[model samples]
Target: MNAPALRLALADDQALVRSGIRALLAGFPQLEVILEAGDGDELLAALAGTSVDVVLSDIRMPGLDGFGLVRALRARGDATPVVLLTTFDEDDLPLRAAEAGAQGFLLKDASPEDLYEAITRVAAGDTLLAPVPTDPVRARYAYRDTSAPTDTFSERQVAILRLLAGGYSNKEIARAVHLSEGTVKNYVSEILDKLGTRDRTRAVLKAITLRII
Candidate 1:
């Protein structure tokens, strides 16, 4: 038998954008948008009664933005996977969203395939950070580029860094990469040192600025 469609809730202040997304998802038979809200608070309230497999939300909603929403849900022990959407101008918000317990992050203008992939992966208990367009990110923080190292990350480091951007903890990263937690911690420290950042958020931002992830 076929699997049931993945039920989804969407939160965005703009009705048109929500409608457009709803329309786009309508084309995917395996996905369903069961609820729509104008902001995080509204979505949270609706979620109190409605069950959904995933949430696709705008990062800059009017009330209780995506980061706040993720924190609130985590505080309430709601583990429902959430994908926070951002526009090109707001490229830095993805790291914050991930740190706040969001399971996925994607550009608002992401292709339908990317959105679909994020929702599916997050729904399946995996974290994801979609490929960000480097041009806008580079343009936003061009000043920092000169300081960024010319050295490239190994394939393994890049994978771990992507998970870091998805907000995975050391333990989670270890499990994902089949390494010990201590090893993951070491890798994280190395990544921070290479990026010259003191924390995961800054490391991720620097990676984006340098077009490394």
Candidate 2:
């Protein structure tokens, strides 16, 4: 039997952008755009009555933009996976998105294949670390004067950091790295401390922003 279609919600201030995305997603029958909204407030209002497997939202809406949307969802203990989209690929944006509880981040110009992969992965409960552009100036601006030693991660820590970037949980990371789950947890905590972050998402994004992983 075929799998059921993945229901989706889209929120963007621009009607044309929402329509364009809805139209693009039309090519994939398994991915359905079940609801659409103009901003985070509208989306939240609809979400009170709607159920969706994933939310694909523009980062900048007129009200309660994408970061706020994710934060709101998390605050309500809603675990629905959210993928944030933006035209600007600033180094700090992905970090901010991660910190806000977004499961994935993508550039608006990303190809259909990329979009499909992002939606599917996040729907499967995986966080995604977007590729960071190489810009030393911007990198310095984003992570300057941090207490974390940028160049001090050991090889083992680096390997674990890479797996964290791939959104592996403690159990998955333990299996991949041949460590106990407890050990993985310890390593993750150390990684966060080394990166000056309070959570796994921020740790991974900060590592990427600093070119540490």
Candidate 3:
């Protein structure tokens, strides 16, 4: 038997953008937009009674933005995965979203296939992030000090960090590094510890900030 369609909740302050996304998603029969909200507050209220498989939220809403929404959902013990949509590739937002428990992040102009893949991946308990170029990441998030104290990662860990910033999954990273998934997981944990962050996304951001990768 085929799987049921996944229900999605969309939250964006702009009505036009929301409508555009809704129309775009309407083409995919496997996904359904069950609820729409203008901000995080409305999104949370709407989610209280609805069963949604994923949330696609704008990061800069007027009240209770995307990060705030993730925190709220986590506080309520709602494990519903969230995919933050943003127009700007802000340096700090990715780390903030990761800390707030967001499972996915994508640019507003991402293709339909990219959006679909992100939703499906996050729904399946995987994290997804839009690939950001390393130059812009370094320029936007890098600190002035070339020799920072936190720049202590092995060459293999640095390679893994680069893949992580490119949004590669643990399995994918394992394949790239020719290592087992379990070993890759250990490397990721070590990388996070070295960066003083708790998640892959944050580790990537910190690595960029410190020029570790």
Candidate 4:
């Protein structure tokens, strides 16, 4: 069977890195290079009128940054999946991206095979991938000392979190649960707070570790 066709965008501050990724991804007959962006703002601008299937971006860009771009996309209710390439695994970038509604995360030094596979999975709506760390990304909730949660989340929040862990978007979850987007957002906020995580994705991961999800 033919590989599924994908209209993809790329964002990286380094022209060299962008070129390298473009070259690697070129081997995938199903993936077309729709556009290249040097920064997050540029990426958003490119997305304004373009119909894209996926975005592979560097986490740290000159303007706006990858996290901000993902957040903006969520704010606009766009579901074009995003995949971030990061140099630091210990920076909380991946977890933050997920909280902001990204599709997946990959390390900058990942093998071409891994990169290709990640794109395929992201397009398929999966988020539970092995943490591909380049330099030990930081945990949103440091489990260094076996600390426990001080507050428990309600059943609704727990349900929201389980779906989040499964990589479903807030809008999707809202529609599934018959709740307004605002209410879902509030539940996410409370979940993060109760889980002692700075972002929802981190909270989800932490919840998994503690068997809370």
Count clashing pairs, candidate 1: 0
Error of 1 at 94 (Å): 2.2
lDDT of 3 by residue, 1-213 (tens): 889999999999999999999998988899999999999999999999997999999999998999899999999999999999999877555555665778777888777766887788789876644333345546786644344435466657765776788677888767655689999999888887666776887777667777554
Candidate 3 stretches greater than 4 Å from native: 129-163, 166-213
Angstrom error of the Cα, residue 67, model 1: value is 1.0
Candidate 2, residue 18: how far the Cα is off, in Å: 0.7
- lDDT of each residue in 1-213, candidate 1, tens digit only: 999999999999999999999998998999999999999999999999988999998888787988888899899999999998877545445556656878777887767866887788789776664444346555664435337653666656866788776667788677656789999899888888887777888787778777676
Q: Candidate 1, residue 196: CA error in Å?
A: 24
The TM-score leader among the candidates is 1
Higher-ranked by TM-score: 1 or 2: 1
Query: Tens digit of lDDT per residue, candidate 2, span 110-180?
Result: 77766887888789866664532235433543653345554487656866775676566778666655689
Ranking by TM-score: 1, 3, 2, 4
The window of 10 residues in a row where model 4 has the poorest summed lDDT is 128-137
Q: lDDT score of model 1?
A: 0.79
| TM-score against truth, every candidate | 0.67, 0.65, 0.66, 0.61
Residue 129, candidate 3: alpha-carbon lDDT: 41
Write one digit per residue (lDDT tens) for candidate 4, span 33-55. 88998999998988999978888
